[model samples]
Target: MTSIFYLHGGPGMSVAVERTRYPQAQEVHWWQQPPATSCAPHPYLDLLEAALVEFRRSVKERGAPMTVMASSFGAHLATHLAQHAPESVERVVLLAPTYNPEQSALRLARRALALHAGHADADKVTAALAAYDAAPGRARFWEVFGALQLLPDVPALYFGPQAGDAPRHFVEVLQQPGGFDGVSAVAISDDFAATFRTPGRSAFNGPVSVLFGRHDPMIDAEHDGPIWRAIFPQASLRMVDSGHFPLLETSLEACLA
Candidate 1:
């Protein structure tokens, strides 16, 4: 059987494994990039690609080739992996992938602000954003992140059973001292952002599957959907009714389908 790998977002974190498991691929393995610091200067591209290449090698005789479901930042890495090692990847599934950084950040920031409009602690988010504007550092970014969490952006209509517990996931990660800082450290590097800003190679012309939430604050569906379709002609786009985190927002059946 072909092995399926699920790559989570947050650069520093992994997807909620328990929530993403579905009947289509009941036992999909999860992959996370190495510490940005560990692979200093190179980001996690080489390491991730090497691992996936190994995965593809393992199941060569299997009925299917290895498939990757990469989310957000992982999507960027997955795209690069396929570009570099086309033979190693069977098909790429971009789940809320961050194909464009500048646009995605604007969309996410706007969603957080809208969710907190006129609500309690709204001032806090405003204050945090203001702080980020002034200092513009990782410390301030986390402050903004904590502030945004106060808003209930994940709608109950589409958010699955794990909706309520979503915030805790990031909170726990933040509580760990210097844990994810490396991710932020490398992420904000001028060199790193530029790589994604201008993908050196042409669009990935390969078998691909793209899924983005209709309510996703991180992806610009109107703009990105067409871009993705143009890049991967064989890709089938599925617009889900969820936010940035689909596993927490959509049902397994909906996700696997």
Candidate 2:
């Protein structure tokens, strides 16, 4: 049987619920991206290095390439891994992968701006986006973008077409220490994007499946679908009926199918 590896999002988002979906898959529980709160930087390189080590070990144990299933930032990491060590990855399943943090944030901000147009928080969204634009460095960008989670209207943007009823397990994970902050910390790292090599699209021609939620505005499928398709030439895009957390909102069978 092919080894399966699961990578969760949030630079530090809890995988308690996500892990359940891939119970048998190998997971990289990043020590650098811990759940506890801290001021220290959780650089992307740190997590990437650790994950690479874990991935290599999994490959060695199975004596073959492994299938990678990742979500959000985890999906981003998986893509990077495919580029960095494509030989170890046989296939990839990306769930709402965030290719560019700045672009993703901008998309979400624009959506939030529209959603809260008449609401009291409309100005807040605009101001946040403005702050992000004026920010001098990646660190400031993450700082500004991360603060969006605090807005009363921002949470609703992640849900799908159904009522915005988030899973209880997911809600608790976000509330965890460092859960949200780790995201900014990792993205703020100077080497977040610059350190990685940008390989050509032909680098990894493995089978790829990209899943997106129909109502997911945070990483809108409409904007990113084409990008992912171009990046992974063999990628097959699917628009599911759930939100950002597809496994939590929709059945795993449907998502995997």
Candidate 3:
């Protein structure tokens, strides 16, 4: 039996949502990165590297070859893990991954920073994030943030109307004091861009699978689908009926099969 590690998206999400999807796995490990702290650096890749170190330690302790199932931003980290530590991972599954930060929600976030910060001052970006964190309802922020991150017409995928509740829960459990600042730094950093290009095709020595919703608004099938296919020639590509977060709507058993 293979041990599976599930990675959640964003800088603030908990492992709870992902854990529920794979109840039957032999063992399920959820990757929890450091919380968003105002004092912490904003660049996400740095945080992601720290998470990878933890993941390697966890994998060693489990004594089982790992299978990684990651969604959205989590997928980005998973890709890096597979690239750098291929021997520890047996298989990879990426759900609605947005590898090209320039095309997805990160771009919107950059634009938002430009609008609010005037000239990309790190302090201003941090302040704006802090304000969003201090907002009364955390879930509302998640929903708004999700909408900004995902494509417009695909609210059902990332957040159904009920998603408001999710963000609230997320805020309660995952919101650290400096989380917003950390995420902002990561979103705007050039290091992430450089990492994306370098990991091109040699990242994984095992089979890789990618699942995406046909209606996914944030990631265009026409663009990303072909790129993935080309990159992972040995990979399997599945298109589901749902949007960005397909695991929320589709069964993990079916997806794994």
Residue by residue across 92-170, what tens digits does model 2's lDDT show?
8888787776577667777766766776656765776777677646766665566565556566567776634555556
lDDT of 1 at 199: 50
Residue 202 Cα positional deviation in candidate 1, in Å, after optimal superposition: 6.2
After superposition, which runs of candidate 2 have C-alpha atoms over 4 Å from their true positions?
20-42, 118-121, 131-143, 163-165, 177-190, 193-198
Please give, for residues 1-257, the per-residue lDDT of candidate 3 as tens digits: 65777787764555655554455655667666565455444456666777689779878998766888888778777877887888888898888887664456533443444444434344444454455556723443343444343322222234433333443434444355433444543443344554445347745778898987665656776688777766666778888776566666566765566
In order of appearance, the predictions have TM-scores of 0.69, 0.78, 0.66
Per-residue lDDT of 76-186 in model 1, one digit per residue for the tens?
A: 667666666676667788777777654465456556677568888888888888888887755666677667767774333223344566555544544566435545444
Kindly provide the TM-score of model 3 when superposed on the true structure, using C-alpha atoms.
Answer: 0.66
Candidate 2 TM-score over all chains jointly: 0.78
Tell how far residue 150 is off in model 1, in angstroms: 7.7
* lDDT of the candidates, in the order given: 0.61, 0.68, 0.62
Residue 162's lDDT within candidate 3 is 31
- Model 2: per-residue Cα lDDT at residue 238: 91
Candidate 3 deviant stretches above 4 angstroms:
20-26, 36-42, 106-198
Selected candidate, larger TM-score, 1 vs 3: 1
Which one wins on lDDT?
Answer: 2
